[model samples]
Target: MKKFNLFKEIIITDRNVLTEAINSGKLFGIRVDGNICYEPFTLDDILIYRGTPDASLPIETIFGKNYQVLEDNDRVLIKAFSNWQEIIGFNSPRATYDDTTADGVDEFSTKEMENIGWHASEFNIKYRTLVDVLEDKCEGTLICIEQEEPYQFSGLGFIDDLADARDVLFEYCQREIQRLINEDEDYAQDNLNDDELEAAEFFKI
Candidate 1:
């Protein structure tokens, strides 16, 4: 049986924190559907399984602690499972880690951000280019952009040129991606699958 670690060592059993983690794109819950399911797990489904006797036994056995440690909070790191045997008792007959790789991480991040309502686009308008707009009015402006939906924009902003703006945006995107990845906790751990680890290592930011 393959070994998989789903989370970092920190044990988070708080319901509110778990919910916040899920909502803020920190922890991803696993959805069991026979053999195949999706990534960015569903919190409610995981919560349901966490309450079950069968799931509790395996979790306790694997973690060497009482199942109540989780407090019915379903949020966990992907690296939490040490092997397939540890997760076999889960609600799903087959628990697979298809999107735990670096590429998978990237795909998950992009889609997750979008699902949470982040809009990314090249600033374009009639006649004037994005560069023109930045150069004309945004130069020497201090601005802060919020990540959550109904984004609140504040301050004045400017860029040296279009290339600079593009780089800034790209850097911002990478930073957000890395931030999402870091939330997984196990992202930098040695316990990850070799392929997934390698993909993560090679992934830029």
Candidate 2:
């Protein structure tokens, strides 16, 4: 219910909006295309050397309209999710936001990533950031499909069979519906209990 100190996520349903956000300097570390460029993001790497594959690259360049990113939580961002164009999902401690309120800011940037514990990208720039993902030309895509849920993503993928994809996504939708029903039941139960308590207090029995 409450995402305290967590990176909020939203599912992107429109590519046009994604392009608009990225072009407006509203995103970074994007992995939309079929290539892998690491940062639209930053890193506090130990040593920027060949020994470490910690070099950064800009991403989200060659997104195919027919593709669909899959759900991935089994791997870390640097492993499966953070590729040139292929995408999975990510996990770790929560982290986002810009550096507007920080002590000072630079002209080209918000100095936002500096407030970092760890960072992630958003579908909307209006959402609070954990770190700056828009390091270069690349930026990740996120969108708000529902008001209650924020950060739940599978990955960036191409839609192979449109019909099949729809069916699969429908399953996801049904699952979400069940979750909503369960949540509503919980709230209703809680309210009923509260009413019962209030009635007991009034009766003084």
Candidate 3:
């Protein structure tokens, strides 16, 4: 089964407000030991984690020592994106496996299997379903919430919480583009040629 690490602080006093904020994506937050502590007032999931002002001690110290302040009536939510994506091979329209022939009259040959069917496989359906989450509008807002120090908005799992499947696909394309660039400098430079680079801006969408 697929799973995700969801760290949420439950607010006993103002439960409704916190829940609403999570749904609407308007909650303010601060980092407490790699976990995001969200405000129970707003409804925006800003994905921002403001650490303690004191630079001497680590953020963890504040949470460890002054945890009572946070635990008063609210709960902290710390969920990792690792459990968001799952590859379930279901309703697979096509199946491709290695077919090897022993060397006898002819030399042994192995075939490379790929998407060799017309219909979507079970795994494909699963993937598609996951992709859909990042494209279509969702009942609740999907956010990339993190409690660690702020970092660039680009990179793997950047769109892991997107509510639109189409947007997820676009994000995937972007990820692939970046991955290719990093993995193959020559290919990236070649692809980045003047005109091609200009036209490639569509991928940013």
Candidate 4:
């Protein structure tokens, strides 16, 4: 049981990954008051929470505080990348333009460029799943979802990138499935009476 401090900012993009996380009984989303309010949130809820703008807040408030997650045991709080600012904080640029825009050529304002640079410098990339990392399609250091015992994505628990992580987890899952199948076969053989074993052997031909 590893621990992660949910108090830090966290990002999740794929809805399916989020859903699986919730169903896995490992993660939870809590409210500001320290109560688990978001545990029942669905994929649609997360999408809406991430997409809808909070009119009550100022425009500068990039990350919406609508929904949040908490580590199941430690009660560590987690926030979603609900806006462009939060996304950029993860080293992902908001947008890019070529030299040929309809209005001739567009350029990022000095302040915008500065913000981008700052985000890259302070980026704390984290991934919810191997698939989420794969979809990112970029190579960089990131943190694994395991919070209790933290490890660098590029070291120790060592993953080259999202693609590598995806392949490794997939292979692990396949091996586990096969292991379960073998266990079932062993249990059947152990429990079967003589007549059942004879019938099973006959079918084996």
TM-scores, all models, native as reference: 0.20, 0.18, 0.20, 0.21
Kindly report which residue stretches of model 3 are placed more than 4 angstroms away from their true locations once superposed.
Answer: 1-163
Ranking by lDDT: 4, 1, 3, 2
Q: Which parts of model 1 have CA positions greater than 4 angstroms off?
A: 1-51, 55-79, 83-99, 106-205
Worst 10 residues of 1 by lDDT: 119-128
* Deviation from native of the Cα of residue 152 in model 4, angstroms: 23
lDDT of 2 by residue, 60-94 (tens): 31223322233233321222222212221221111
Q: Where in model 4 is the C-alpha error above 4 Å?
A: 1-160, 185-205
Estimate, for each residue in 83-186, the C-alpha lDDT of model 3 and write its tens digit.
21210011011111111112111110112101211111211223333324332432322222234455211111122222343444445555555565567765
**Cα deviation of 16, candidate 1, in Å:** 17
Better of 1 and 2 by TM-score: 1
**RMSD from true fold, candidate 1:** 20.3
Q: By TM-score, how accurate is candidate 1?
A: 0.20
Q: What is the lDDT, from 0 to 100, of the residue 45 in candidate 2?
A: 13
- Model 4 C-alpha lDDT versus the unseen true structure: 0.32
Model 2 stretches astray by more than 4 angstroms: 1-156, 183-205
- Against the unseen true structure, what C-alpha lDDT does each candidate score? 0.31, 0.26, 0.30, 0.32
Q: Weakest 10 consecutive residues, lDDT, candidate 3?
A: 86-95
Q: How many Å off is the CA of 153 in candidate 3?
A: 39
